[model samples]
Structure formats: structure tokens, C-alpha cells
Target: MPDTSSRIARPRLIEIIAALATGGLLTLMVLSNSMMAAHTTPLFSSLTAHGVGSVVAGIALWGVWLLRRGQAEPIAKRHIPLWAYLGGISGALTVIITSSTANSALALTGTLALGLAGQVVLALIFDVFGAMGIERRLPRKNDLIALAAIIAGTILIIFARGAS
Candidate 1:
């Protein structure tokens, strides 16, 4: 039988908090970009918002890295790759496309759903291929089932938006 814990450890609690925080931040980012796009060109809004966000996040990370200088170990060479450094480019593309989509017929829910579905599919492929230096973890049957459901839901949301 598996043992059940009465309380969470600090590291586990931190992980939970980080996960929730990421979700909250992403929600806010989508809403913010959409709102901004409503007032200006999607490309301009994406550029401005993503630019500021990148600078702020970079500065914050720099500060943290400075403070942690001897306390934390550096990333191992095996885990680092040129492609891994292209996350900023990916973020830029994501912001541009999301802003444009959010301003189009898809609106918020449809755009987000479709984007998430695409991401889930790509993530599964990446995991299976061990792309970008990640350890390979083959997708299970449940993953494929979940992806199908997500795609179906996205299609429903998009068509429902059109019908309304």
C-alpha cells in the first residue's frame, strides 16, 4: 500500500506554489495582450508588452543569478544546447501570434484553447523525440486520449464562437 503524508514538505510546497503562479501569470499575460491588442495593432502591442516583459524578467533573473553566485551550481554542459537558448525567440513568436489571434474571430477562449492544444501536441512530440536536450519520455495512451479531447474541445469552442 502507498503511504499518505499529512503535510507537504517545503520543496514540494514551493513546487506547487510555482505551478499555480505560472498558471496565474499566463492567464494574466493572455488577457493583458488581448486587451492591449484591442487598443492598438496586434504586432505593436505584442512587441511592446513582450519587450518590457523580457527586460523585466531578464533583470530579475540577473539579480537572482548574482545573489546565488557561489551557492548554486552551474548548468551541466550536457543539458545546454544552442536550441535551448532560442526560448526568447519562441516567446516572441508566441506573443505575436497570440495577440493576433486574440484580436481575431477566435477571441480569448478559442484562441487560448487552440494554442494550448497545439502546445500539448508539440510537447508530446518533443518528449517522444527528446528534442532540445530534454530526456525522452514517451507519451502514454492517456496522453493521446487527453490530446484528442483537447482538440475536440478547441474545435467546439471555435465553432461555437462562430455560431454565436
Candidate 2:
């Protein structure tokens, strides 16, 4: 086995914490969206979520701008590719799809498990091909092992849920 001394170094620990926090927040978001979808439609739930997110993001950006108004260095301007703007569309679709699945027999647990599996697969592909300006890197042995474990767990969770 590789040396494990640095496994939880400060930076890595911070990343782990951040990932955990994000996952918790995501679960809450999915639950809220699915509940709304149950009463309203999936499309409506997605639209409402996105609308609120946009307003919140806009306010955050405005606050950041105000805080940095007197900075000496100018903010660098980079041309954002059209594809970069498509994330909102993807987010909307994700909400709609997850909402529908969460309300089905799959429920939140199965839906999250499958979604995580899909995300891992796509992330691996993206990393290999350097999609969306990400650094191109081949999966290491540990990476593959982790991916396998995640996929196996996802399959077990999904099937177990279905069998119940």
C-alpha cells in the first residue's frame, strides 16, 4: 500500500470537508425540489429553483463587486465561450430529471446513488479528454479503484432499493 501519512493533509482535508458539505447541501436541494415537484410539475419546480438561484447568485456577485470596488488592479476580462453559458440549461435539466426520479419508486436515496454514478463516469471521461478546459489526466490505479467502488455501491443501492 502507498504511504498514507499525507492522505489527510491540510489542503486535502479542506477539500474533503468541502465535498461533504456540498453533498449535504445537494441532498437538501434534491429533497426540496422533489417535494415541490410532487405538488407542482417538475418543470415548474426546476424553473422556481433556477429563478431563486439566479437571484441569489446575482446578489452575491453584486456584493463581491462592491467589496472590490476600490481595488488597484483591474479585474481580468476573459471571453467566455458560448458553451460555458449552457450550465444553467444543464442545471435545469438535472433538477427536472432528479425531481421526477425522486418522486418515483427510486426515491431520494436511489436517485442520488444513480446520479453520483453517472457523475463519476462523466467526470472520468472529462478528465481523460480535458473537456471544458480541464486538465487532461489519465486515471491512476487508485482512481480506477475508487470509481469501481462507487459504481459497485451505486448498483447495490439501486438494486436493493428496487428489491424492497
Candidate 3:
């Protein structure tokens, strides 16, 4: 039998914590930005795209936590470099800068959509070909299809909101 302990390590735990914290912070930033946007002309809606993302990321976190607690007690998550986290923060800052300078609602929603798409893609890729302390947690093909469908649905919802 394979030595399971060797596969899991401390760095992975740190990544999980960092990812969770980052996701939460992004959610807060977007909602607060939405309120700020409300002061502008029809630029703000009650439902910000980041709110949806908060749920998605939260679910991802829950799944990871469950896996660690139950099936893989000692499983450490992948450790991402400081740069990766900074990259996301930079993207958010870019959105802020753009929104401040010009007609930014369009760009903001598009950026948010793109960000969500990236998460979906990363999760799916990780599920299909496990990486970064995350294992292929789903065993069935249907799970993959379901995840894809959800991402598609989320995109449609955001687009529909923007249309109105």
C-alpha cells in the first residue's frame, strides 16, 4: 500500500486557510463596492456578482474541510506562492482603479464574470487532474457535468442581471 502520510503536508493546510481568507475578503470587497456603486447612476444592483462567487468559494472551502476532517484527516492542501495571491489582489485593485476613472460597471461585471470563470476552470481542472494539495475528490463523471452546468448557469444569471 502507498504511504498516505507522505502525500499530505503542512503547506497544504496553509494554502487552504489562505484561499479561504482570500475568497472571503474578495466577497466583502465586492459587496462594499456594490454599495459604493449604488451612489452612481444605474450602475449598482442589489446583487453583486461577487456575492455569487462567495457562495461558490465557500462551498469549495467546506468540501476541502470535510475532506481533511473525514476521508483524509492529515491531508495538507497545496501551498501557493505569495505572488499568486497578490495577482488576484492586483486584479481587484485594477478593477477599483478602472471603476474610479471611467464608465466601469461594464468592465467590473465582465471582470467579475471572468474571475468566476477562472475559479470554475481551476476547480474543474483540479478535479479532473488533481493538483495543489487538492485531490480528485469527485469520482463520478456526473459530478463534473453538474459543476460545469452550475458555472454555465451562473454566467447566464450574471448576464441576465446586467441586461436589466
Best by TM-score: 2
TM per candidate comes to 0.64, 0.76, 0.42
lDDT of 3 by residue, 1-164 (tens): 54433233233578879977997897787677767677763234323444666799999999988777746355675676676655556555655555554455555458658778766777767766666554545435665576679778878988887678
Pairs of colliding residues, candidate 3: 12-77
Q: Judging by lDDT, tell me the better candidate of 2 and 3.
A: 2
lDDT of 2: 0.78
Tell me the spans in candidate 3 whose CA falls farther than 4 Å from its real position: 1-29, 36-106
Which candidate tops lDDT? 2
Candidate 1 has an lDDT of 0.73
Q: Cα RMSDs of all predictions?
A: 7.2, 6.1, 11.4
lDDT leaderboard ranking: 2, 1, 3
Rank order by TM-score, top first? 2, 1, 3
Question: Weakest 10 consecutive residues, lDDT, candidate 3?
Answer: 2-11
Query: What are the per-residue Cα lDDT tens digits for candidate 1 across 78-164?
Result: 545677777878877877677668778888667767777788878877767676545666656765686688578767866787667
lDDT of 2 by residue, 27-89 (tens): 899789879978998888888888898899999999999998988886776677999989878
Residue 131, candidate 1: C-alpha displacement in angstroms: 1.1
lDDT of 1 at 29: 87
